[model samples]
Target chain A: MAPVKNGRYLFNEIPSGYPIPGQTTVYDESETIDLDTVPLNGGALVKLLVVSIDPYLRGRMRRAEAKSYNEPFKIGEPLMNWGVGLVLRSDSSSVKAGDHVYGYFKFQQYEIVDATRVLVLENKEGLPWSAYVGVAGMPGQTAYHAWKEFAEAKKGDTVFVTTGAGVVGATVVQLAKADGLKVIASAGSDDKVEFMKSIGVDVPFNYKTTKTAEVLEKEGPINVYWDNVGGESFEAAIEYAAKGARFIECGMISGYNTSEVYQVKNLMKIVTKQLHIHGFIVTDLMPKYNPEFYSSFVGRIGRGEIAYKEHLLVGLERAGEGILDVQSGRNFGKCVIVVGEDKA
Target chain B: MAPVKNGRYLFNEIPSGYPIPGQTTVYDESETIDLDTVPLNGGALVKLLVVSIDPYLRGRMRRAEAKSYNEPFKIGEPLMNWGVGLVLRSDSSSVKAGDHVYGYFKFQQYEIVDATRVLVLENKEGLPWSAYVGVAGMPGQTAYHAWKEFAEAKKGDTVFVTTGAGVVGATVVQLAKADGLKVIASAGSDDKVEFMKSIGVDVPFNYKTTKTAEVLEKEGPINVYWDNVGGESFEAAIEYAAKGARFIECGMISGYNTSEVYQVKNLMKIVTKQLHIHGFIVTDLMPKYNPEFYSSFVGRIGRGEIAYKEHLLVGLERAGEGILDVQSGRNFGKCVIVVGEDKA
Candidate 1:
């Protein structure tokens, strides 16, 4: 084949608040990668199949270095995140040509990466290739780590998950149910609430319409709070937390895009209720938990014991649109860009 | 003994913010308790010698039933807290008629309590009777439990204690120093800064004059924080916390008397820095750690290795003023009302 045309998204300017389309420049043919030009350093040339768009990417887009757990995305560089691809050419014995793999890579159509840096997807188990970017991937591992390590979830425990219809929250809801815990979930819209209900959420409420504190007062005394959306939801969780409750601080999507952070007034409840509020990044826990996650979590997904949803936007040029959809809560579930066909 | 005419302070009305003079009622010679009157239960009749005034009393003054770890003081009843006393008569064998003891009791000139409810002070070590209510008592126990159980303070670790010159903060500063930890303390006034310095604080700053965040950035990336005064101070601690720091939440005196709690905006630092912020009531840990506290901690105080200060008001009628002094940060150390002389 004559060199395949490569398309990529570039970080143009750091956003002040919510990122706009102009902040990221999309080039349909940013470069051309020749198959004959494979690296001699035991690397693989891969065609990107799917790119996972996550909320944490917003924190990396700051003008100044935000004191964060992860490094900020450099301006004038290709935005990088978790993605899965098919190896078109390989010089390494670890991964051969046509092997499916996933790892951190740029949001581009095609690229060459060191074979040791990417994990070969050994057992897709006849599942959709996109599953490697969603339930059977990072988000799935995050839910697993949080529940097992931080939540201390037990049978008959009551858990409240914010953004319940989203990828991580939905997975957590199903996991809690499977473990015999009652799950209460909150979402922004009616459809999302219904989606959570369909997925075995014991109680689902539209947070925009019904007050979380009011609903919690009626239905709660929450034992575990899986906080995906912060600000008001955090305050509500504090108000309804059982004594010695576990507050798993997964993400703060509510404050990610806003210039003004939500002023949490009732943090004293942490003391009064003797609650434990712990925040963690999934990548930080992966090295220790990845083996169990890949073995146990992957088998569950393969057997359909766990389910997932995805909103796939085709082509690398639409990556920015996918991020915007996720940011606006317009996307139904795990948002991903389908860069090329999975020929597995 | 002319019946030893008794005076008492009663909880009148709950205050909206800070307790005013009228919120607590001072009754001089309210009733004459005849020494002849003895309880049906085998109890001791004690002449209250000193009443310990504490910041936590503000929480008990809230009109609404705050979901607190402790019970609220009832209106129309004598305000109760840790107090030191001289036994006038004994119906039980725990103590004799002339023994000096201390425990939780009413803020009154004299009262009858079950003998099992009080602990006799065995070794005065030439320390003042007031020491039982200050250094050798509840506040001391609080600091001990916090450091031993939650702080996990290590040698060379930098600890920042808010209200550094006050009872609990001063005790914490001394304890940390004894443990070979470097100490940074903040107080509201210049004299308090000097007081903190006298107690061996490595760095002392008047929070009113110098910004806690700026001073901390200059002097430290605090490894452990003992939070006595929350709000701006807690926010400042979050801004300068070292990675894997421990924040010991002792009290929020800054917000105790205010209608509006300070909005802590930098709490996300807890996640980024992987900090552990745990709030504990000293009493909760007493059952588990009190033996160590009394045995090891009391010996330290007796040997002059641990020091303390008392801001004493001369009469039971001055209890309201004592509380107000603590509220306004006017009291230099452990505020207490000296109700009567210790005649042991």
Candidate 2:
């Protein structure tokens, strides 16, 4: 390969207020090139190919405590992030270079990771490497584990999921369909509605156009609400929740700019209907943060049991805007920054 | 002995706004009393001694599918409610005349419950009978279960509890104390503050005087928020919640009739902190709606291992106003309408 030069996009500056245009910074390969010598002390180098952009990253950019899942990115240093990668070099030899893997890493062209944090891929199978950064990664794990642990989803129950075509939400819709439930999802556009339908969401509504309450009144008293967007979506979920409903709070994309502070009319529902609304981080609920739960999911994608779609931005330079697009609900499916081809 | 009456406080007219004089139509005692027969079914017939006057009862008077814990009280009925009582007769022998019990009952002077719902007062040593309506009753169970199961408190953690001297809140403050944590509480009056302190709340702030945010900032970053009031109290809890905190949604007395809505800000605390805020009904979380838990608690109280207290208002004439006073945060302890006094 072209004598591996440098890294790419990372949390450059802690963002304040809304992300202004051109907030993300990237390094030219020539300027930040690593020395020809690898770390002999004990390190492995990986060439990151695909990095996932999720709505939660915006919260990480902010200077706040009480974060949901992963800790916030440090203010100045290159923002550490999550991605699918290919191992380019290794020192302690559990395996040689050129094996595929994925895990949390900095947004970079090439970087070193402690051997333990680097999960080596055994089989790419027929599934593209991108699936690791989307469906077969945290997205699928979060969806499956959340439903299994927090929510009680029986067959024939009406399911409501906001940001339905998102990484985790999309997986949840499919998982619910597999279990024989009626799925009603909310997305941002008409095209997304069609996209959701292809993947098993029976009724997908464009929340921007149709009011969630009016639709729920005609069709609902929904039994389960997998909330991806928090503000208006949470209000809708609380309004339509059936008696003994289960509200699984996944993320809050809609109210990222505003940690909503106001009164809720449905306060009585929590007691009257005896609703069980829970806010959880998937990793925390797991008995052990095991890859086994994800293995079957990966196998599904590898065997073509599920579809893994992605919004791939061409260069690491484009990731900043890609993150903005994903955060603002402009991009559909799993947003990924394709930093480089796995050409070792 | 006074003959039992079945007259009701009816919602003959829906209030256009906040409650005023004449909104409740109390049918005269002469209208519904059944004085002809002393005979009753076996294992039933309770002489109600204490009735709960929680603020959420106000919602039952309305005519909407507003979120609620108990179904709205039917308009023409005396209004089904929660109470502690003494059995007048019991042919089934599970309970005999003069035994104390607690469960769902009516607002009338006497009630005949089947064997299915009555919880017998088996252990009454250090604990008083009033605890059956207060700390050792439904309110106590609600506080204990919510704070334990949902909030997951541990030693040295900081907790914030609203409506601190109310029946449930007072118990929650002590239960949290028993677990070895610092508690910051909000109450309406200075006397209530002293009551909270007596019950183990470390810092009691009179909510009527001090701003909630100011109190939280001075003594916060709370690990658990036991909210006994939903309106602005719920909003402030979210703001003060610590990273990875658990917010326990207990009740909302603050917004009894103002706009029928509760608002909350600082919602981003959910994701950013990975918060596990749960809106729950204690009965559901406890298996069999509280058999072992309640009985074990009673055992504790009898052994002087637990100390529970309450506020009792004498006579049925003031029951309506007692309920209103409880809703207004005027009661210093558990709000119970006393229907009789033991002649002992």
TM-score winner: 1
In model 1, which regions exceed 4 Å deviation?
B64-67, B93-96, B124-126
lDDT (Cα, 0-100) at B131 in candidate 2:
71
The lDDT leader among the candidates is 1
- For model 1, how does the per-residue alpha-carbon lDDT over B136-234 read when each residue is reduced to its tens digit? 888888888878888888899999998888878899999899889989999989988888888899999898888899989888899999988788888
Poorest lDDT segment (10 consecutive residues) of candidate 1 chain A: A21-30
Q: Which lDDT values do the candidates have, in the order given?
A: 0.83, 0.72
**CAPRI classification of candidate 2:** acceptable
lDDT agreement of model 1 with the native:
0.83
Backbone clash pairs in model 1 (N, Cα, C under 3 Å; residues 3+ apart or in different chains), count: 0
- What's the C-alpha lDDT at position B271 in model 2? 55
Q: Interface RMSD (Å) of model 1?
A: 1.7
C-alpha lDDT of residue B148 in model 1: 88
TM-score of each model, paired residue for residue:
0.94, 0.87
